[model samples]
Target: MNREFIKKLCEETHACVRILEGPIGTNDRIVLISAKEEPDLEISPAMDAFLRVFKHVNDISYGTGGSTDQIAAYFTACSVWLLVASQQAINLIGKQGSSIKSIQESTDATIRVISGA
Candidate 1:
């Protein structure tokens, strides 16, 4: 829940997004083939780490009902990461477009709730 942790989460999320998008300048069709085979593979580690931290913060936030500011900030950061990750999924997984859209929408809603806007 510190600045350093938030920074690391953003960096990891960016890397996962890039991995989902595949290597640059590759054939789109071939990338699609590989993506179809392992749509959820590359982002698993980053997602796992993010979820662990997120759940920890959520549990603490609920248990204490204090530090609302800090908890809100952490939730906001996590929501941003989820938003970016889901958008990357949508961009990369053509065959699973609808599923990715749902993820993006869900993440967007979470962001709104966390940001109180």
Candidate 2:
């Protein structure tokens, strides 16, 4: 994995991530800034995928106990993961007209694989 890339993401978003802790569940469970760190800033699907990844609203979570910037940074980091996740989906699509659900599942599988889930 690209440690620097993840670190850069956290730096820009002002958050930190501990890979060993890993995602709570789902092959593509995204905490956005990720649950990797306690987000302290506002996070959206553009900047994260908590809601996007989790179909259940009550299941998607955002941090509530840290600096706003920290939360933003954390989301930013998760955004980075989302970025990577998107890339994976794109790759899975390749030249084939793949189904959206299939692409999502493929990318989600990749996220957990890369995140040490």
Candidate 3:
């Protein structure tokens, strides 16, 4: 539920997460960044799946008041799925270049928007 705990979980799972705490009356933000340089177009689809899962996780963590362990477990599952999706995207792309880099950034930006990062 707290920043440090979620951060630790993210690190253990090798996921890139940036938690931003806002000013008074503002809610904290959780951002997931891509570690890959040239992921495929499939990355967008993977991100779509991640967003859906994230919504459920958010509901459980903020709405239902799940335990720390439960949240941790759900996050772990999400992280694993994200990693697999990233890997799959990379595998599908297979090479790096200016075009691939452009696509990667585009996809990353799309993910950031969708994830509210």
Candidate 4:
């Protein structure tokens, strides 16, 4: 919720994405091997949150009460979460007077548009 928390969350999210996406070649292979060797690989807080969201979406999408409206709402919630996370990341980085102005601007605009909707 705070700036520091958001910054850490963004970093973790990026790490989790990279690990899941798997880069090319030896480094990728090492990460995979390490993951397998250490079954209890540490999951970042952000990734944990994402997994929870994913579970909820899956449950809602497949449960007995599933409906078109519910599925739509779930996806909408996911989009909002993503936008908020991105906005927080941009804010945290911008506070240091970094040079990613275009990314920050675009993220702000997307958040605003989604919030307006």
Candidate 5:
């Protein structure tokens, strides 16, 4: 765990994309460790409780993304919620995805700013 990030609040409004996107600039991939297809009894009292408790995930490996940068990449695994949360995954796809062309357009613009284009 990163001691620096432990105290900081989560500020991600964009839905998380769990598939490994190779790597985020300088860090290794983030993985999902716990939360299985069916969680053990100790993890939850009911299915709904299990769903609610682990709705969001913490990164299991060190991810490389600038906390203060306008646009940065994050490399992490699918939270187990991703497997069960279709609506949530759809929401992320809607926000971060579209046609690849649209994503390319946005990334192109962002790259210009980074490269002083």
Candidate 6:
């Protein structure tokens, strides 16, 4: 695992993406995790809780049986999408536009930003 790369990504995303080692029920599973915390904050309380709780009952892996590189890439892409979406919402609010057309435009812009189109 490229620990440095992941650490930097987590920092950039404000702990939105994390990696956990030896979670419960798995003999050996190093999982890269992402969850969108509602009522988001710069430091998400829900994210902190998620990192703490682990059990054999609820094991959430975005992509099971994937390599470390693939997991890292998935996490990074998700973080980028979140960032873009947040920005779009903020911009929409700033314009005082919350109509369906405005939302559609924001979504389109977010897609373009992430896809580099």
Tens digit of per-residue lDDT, candidate 1, span 48-105: 4545355554564435333435556545454333333454644544564555456568
Kindly report which residue stretches of model 3 are placed more than 4 angstroms away from their true locations once superposed. 1-14, 30-32, 38-41, 44-53, 60-117
* Segments in model 6 whose C-alpha atoms lie over 4 Å from true places: 16-27, 32-117
**Candidate 4 residue lDDT tens string, 31-68:** 11111123365764444445534444356533523243
Error of 3 at 71 (Å): 19
For model 6, name the residue pairs that clash. Answer: none
- Angstrom error of the Cα, residue 80, model 6: value is 20
Report lDDT (Cα) of residue 77, candidate 5: 29
Off by over 4 Å in 5: 8-85, 91-100, 109-117
Please give, for residues 24-97, the per-residue lDDT of candidate 3 as tens digits.
68674444544333355434433433443465556554443334454555543433223235545555455654
The models' CA-based lDDT, in order, is 0.43, 0.43, 0.44, 0.41, 0.32, 0.44
Candidate 5 backbone overlaps, count: 0
Measured with C-alpha atoms, the lDDT of residue 102 in candidate 4 is 57
RMSD of each: 12.8, 14.7, 12.6, 16.4, 14.0, 14.1
Residue pairs with backbone atoms closer than 3 Å in model 2 (clashes):
13-73, 33-74, 33-75, 39-71, 40-68, 40-71, 41-71, 41-72
Which tens-of-lDDT digit does each residue in 10-116 have in candidate 2? 56545443344445675553343443443454663233433322222333234443333434443323333443575575664555545554655754532322432
Clashing pairs in 5: none
lDDT of 2 at 99: 54
Rank the candidate models, highest lDDT first: 3, 6, 1, 2, 4, 5
Using Cα atoms with residue i matched to residue i, what is each candidate's TM-score against the true structure?
Answer: 0.27, 0.23, 0.28, 0.23, 0.21, 0.23
Best model per lDDT = 3
Candidate 5 structure quality by residue, lDDT tens digits, 1-117: 342232221221211223243345855544222322334443322332223223323332233232313112333222232232454545434554654346558644321111112
Task: Give candidate 4 regions above 4 Å deviation.
Answer: 1-42, 58-78, 82-90, 93-109, 113-117
Model 3, residue 108: displacement in angstroms? 22
